[model samples]
Target: MGDRLLEHEELLRELAAVQDWPLPKRMKWAKRRRKEQFRHWKRWIETDEAQSKCARPRKNSNPPDLKFASEIVLLEASARNDVDEVIAFLDEGVDPNLTNIDGLTALHQCCIDNCVDLATVLLEHGANVNARDIEMWTPLHAASRCGHLVLVRLLLEHGADLVAVNSDGQMPYEIAETSAVLLELQEAMEKNGFDDGAIEDARNSGPLQMLSDVKELCDRGEPLSLADAHGVTLLHIAASNGYTQVVECLLTNEAAIDPRDRDGWTPLHGAACWGQYEVIELLAEYGADLDAVTGTDETPTMLASDQNITLLLHDLKTRQLERSARNKSRPRSRTFSSSSRGHSVKRDSVNKKSHFSKRDIAEEGKQFKADADSTTGDVDDVVIGSLDDENGGNASESEQSVFSTDSAEKKALRRSKSPPILIKTSDPIQEETEGENNGSMAQRDNVVQAALAPSTLEGQDSKAELVSKETPPLRRRHRSENTSGKCCTIL
Candidate 1:
């Protein structure tokens, strides 16, 4: 058998054919060999990965030891409380930092299972002692809540955060129900120099506070953008936790938006990673950069794992693109809209702007037209009377010529006699026809403005001055007309 390598299948068949090696002997021998093979592969992979992490050159090694048919998931191994399997997998280059679907790391699982040995091994391999799961729960939270005293001590000694608040605003010590666990946490806190007052102060300062807490801080005139030791600001905490009102308060108070935490994660990054949908939308509204990268070079968009969050980002991106495009082409569109009519006008340039809605403008236009015609008629009658006075009630041929003229000529005279009220407005008949064809209120206003265009900028300036001078007189007239002696709203 030493002369050449025998396949495992062939070896199994040979063992079966052997009379000396009975069923019990074969089973014992196979178990011993499997353990030896597993141990050998574990050590080799462990060394290679550790060296790689240290930036050292690697040596050629055997492909993964397929001693077992397949490797179990790291989470599954920890959940099963299989210390050997967990260690084997960890040794074979599975990252202790890798999380399952619930964002639970192997350390988290170890704490949940109360597996002190597994937790120790994972920590030795550099598992984060304070790794927060999806609900912002640390391993200490799991162990403390499960009343696993050994696991709690192991985690605390490994530097687990005692006062790290979870999604429900409960800390590890707060959740620690057993007297033993509570006493241990309290002792740890005292040893670490954390006092009751200090803990309470820290908790109050956190962005996870209620609106009333925020209001209290505001009353005290305390600074809004409070940061912890890790440089996590109130915006970061509120955003990650989906506290919309708190986030809005922080923002309205002019708190820093893009402040990065210890890991270069902004509030947006935290919100996206934790699947805070409304918070993500709120951040986008506040102009949070979608492309801001973390220390690991991952963007908020890349960190977003939820379907709704991705959809929200997609919509925000679409709106941003549309807004940019609209802004870029606004001047051109405005220019085109102003000149859509046949005539030229400078409506926007006028100083005395008539702020009127569609209905108000139409009503004012009709009312003004009637007033202008009445004024024209009065002025024409005065001129005709003065001509008659000049001729002394004369029967002169020129005076008689007016009445003798054709009806068309008389109508032309009356039309020409009116002030230039309709100069800015289109012919009423033409405007009606166009309005019927195209019912756009904005477009019709543009046409009126285009026709009202002054011949030159100098002319426009004179028109503005004239309108300014005329407005006070118009208002005075309306006020005098009011029998109640109250100021009339001269529209």
Candidate 2:
């Protein structure tokens, strides 16, 4: 065998026969069978039938380590005022609105550094001019405070709200360091179509001094919704000063009643804080939101010092509850629901009223039948004829059948049903579909909710609770020793 291996063709044959030597010696027959099968498979694979099933491999797949770096690159370029670099990154699909660790967008940083060209580039690339930082400070605020007149003009021209306040309750104009920047902001605001005269009148003087001028402007078809540098609207000022007619005039011009100032103070909140009972009543009458909470989560009643003002708010709340209860008791005939967008007309009450007698409905049905006959090719007769010809010839019978079905539907609609009050229970109880002669357990749940409604007085400590005569009070310093005047004085 060694002598035969010396020849290349002889060595190949010998190697192929002994290729299965790793197999068990007892399974030598099985190895011979496998070798024969392998030879057949190799021959088949070379044919077209086997070649058609194989697919060509793909190339240049995305690798796992490719990280996103365009935002950081764009931010660095913008900060350094490298216009070309910034442009290159932007062209390569960097987001202009991408914010940094401090929530400062490219536009904000450019304005801070007074980079007018960079700001223009970022704005043209679709950066938000009014984008607020983490502190809620807009680019306009930064530009004005930094005394960049040109950048301030650019921001105002792009429709930035000058009255927008930061988290610290400071507007752009309020933080402006120089008169030149403030004057430019005012001019830009006016040129951008603000009510400059009304705004100046509202900001420069009290409501008593400026009411006539504001009314004249309102007469000239000028809007009264302009806000001052402190984000206080003309209506807010009027409400704060207890100027009832001014408030009414502003409302007559369709001014918003619940516009909030920088500190989340609405007109009602200002009225309550100043103990303006008349303004509070007027605002409540105009449907101002009574449950609105301030930035500190204080309600109007919680901020009022005068007990009368607090009592007025409570009375208004009680009246509102009574009105809602009355409206729920009656069957509404028609309701016109007015909203900010538009008013909607709903006629559910016409079908709900049960006062119409059977005789009246019969007469109305006869009148409807007469009208249907007057019109050519009555729809019901045509449909009945197509369905069953024998029933179609009797038009009166068909009309009567239709009228009777409609009367049945109307009667069903006339049956009024009240919604059930759902009550959660710690222990599951059997559902009671009918009410008892007196109060049910569900009524107790509603009473509990009513008692829990918040209406705390101003300067009252929330941590203290009412104590019974048997319970001991916490130790405290003597009232005479407390010069802070914060001690409670019981009547």
Candidate 3:
């Protein structure tokens, strides 16, 4: 046997690698490695240490009595507050960590049922407070979600993980159903040394609670126009989803009515595209710009899905244009009124001064000289006194007349405020005549002329006009053509 085993050592190694060997091949190898066949080769092949080193533990081979007949039954009994059945199973040596098919332990059931006494009994018998179910939901997550504040507090005291996230990326505190549950979780977190951010997280606990937290933060001096990573504001989210109350709350806090996201989509654009009728009307009432174009040149009216919204935006645009026209017309009346008032003041001053003649002016001057000599003042002082009127009231009138040059000043002021008018004409014969006379060509699409203010010169409005000679318009390439040397259409 020793000689045979020594000779077949390499064959045995090969046999071990072949998992699907024939039964005869397996039996032959098994017979050689048996204790009875290895008397002299015991130290090398048949020792207990060598056998143990090469042994593979059997898979799922537990004794039938050791496995529980019903783990879910035990959990159900524990959840229903049947303390007797729970104690009977624990005393019968049932595994405390035995979970149902969904991986939920008995303590998780107790949490969902809000059975505090059952939770205490299971915890005493070594139930895990942080044991996760199929969705990675801890027992505390179940309790928090169902607004079981007392069970949440009890689980926290038993050392549950505070920040464990479930399958939905939500913490137990984040999905807490009621404010009471959220507050209880927050207090527990605070006692465990968490700071103010924990309380803030509790305030923003659930999906619907996020909106209320936004308003509270605004009241606490946070900016209502705060934007997220995507540059989406709270109003954009609320308006897009038709949260009319949240939208009104945000607008009442003075949020920007037309804040645009990174995609150049305003809140009005979002509401319009989603057909949020009330939100669209609220945004329009707060003065959202209807004509504000997006990055793709699409206006709110163009993006709107509802015909009513489109018509409303159209009316807003028309009203805005009319208002701008009225504003432009108002400046002309203001200019004319200012000019007439200046002329009236000048005429009044001229009539009052015309009453004194040149002879009266010389006689008054001699009388003032005699009074100056009688006072015995300096010669320079007497000369300065002679320059002043006796009553001193005419000095201010003279100063006003010196500075009021209305016609030239008003013309220059108006010219500086107004932009130049752009003109275009299509008459080829007139263009040729003007080009030949002025030594320049006229642009076909746009012609910008610089004109100075009008002045009274030989019964004509005299103004110096400077002409910036036109350059040849660049030819555009087809959409598919290369723009290597030509100007590309800039977005």
lDDT for each residue of candidate 2 in 293-397, tens digit (9 for 90 to 100): 988999998988789878989999898889889989999687555775456444556545544444455455445333433331222222233223233334476
**Distance from true position, residue 370, model 2, in Å?**
99
Give the lowest summed-lDDT range of ten residues in model 3. Answer: 423-432
Q: Alpha carbon lDDT of residue 376, candidate 2?
A: 19
Query: Considering every candidate listed, which one attains the maximal lDDT?
Result: 1
Query: For candidate 3, lDDT tens digit of each residue in 1-491?
Result: 44444448776666667558888987876776675445655656667877886796766667766844668668767767898899888988776678876888988888888888888888889988889885668999999998998888888888997877664456887899999999988877777876768644643453256567876787799888878866888888778767678888888889999888888999999888877788877887787888778889998888988798888778767877787799888856444455756556434465566554544554554453344333222212222222232224244565445433234333434443554332211111111133342332232121212111132121223212211123222221122233222222221
lDDT of candidates 1 onward, in order: 0.69, 0.66, 0.65
Instruction: Show model 1 residue runs off by greater than 4 Å.
Output: 1-111, 115-165, 168-208, 331-491
Over 164-276, each residue of candidate 1 has an lDDT whose tens digit, in order, gives: 87876678889996999999999998898888787876665556457668778878889877788788887887888778888888788777789998889999998988788
TM-score of each: 0.34, 0.29, 0.28
lDDT of 1 at 220: 86
Candidates in order: C-alpha RMSD to true structure: 23.7, 42.1, 30.0
* Candidates ranked, most accurate by lDDT first: 1, 2, 3
Residue 281 C-alpha lDDT in model 2: 86
Instruction: Give model 2's TM-score versus the native structure.
Output: 0.29
- Residue 80's lDDT in candidate 2: 95
Error of 1 at 299 (Å): 0.9
Give the clashing residue pairs of candidate 1, or none: 345-453, 424-452
Cα error, candidate 3, residue 223 (Å): 1.3
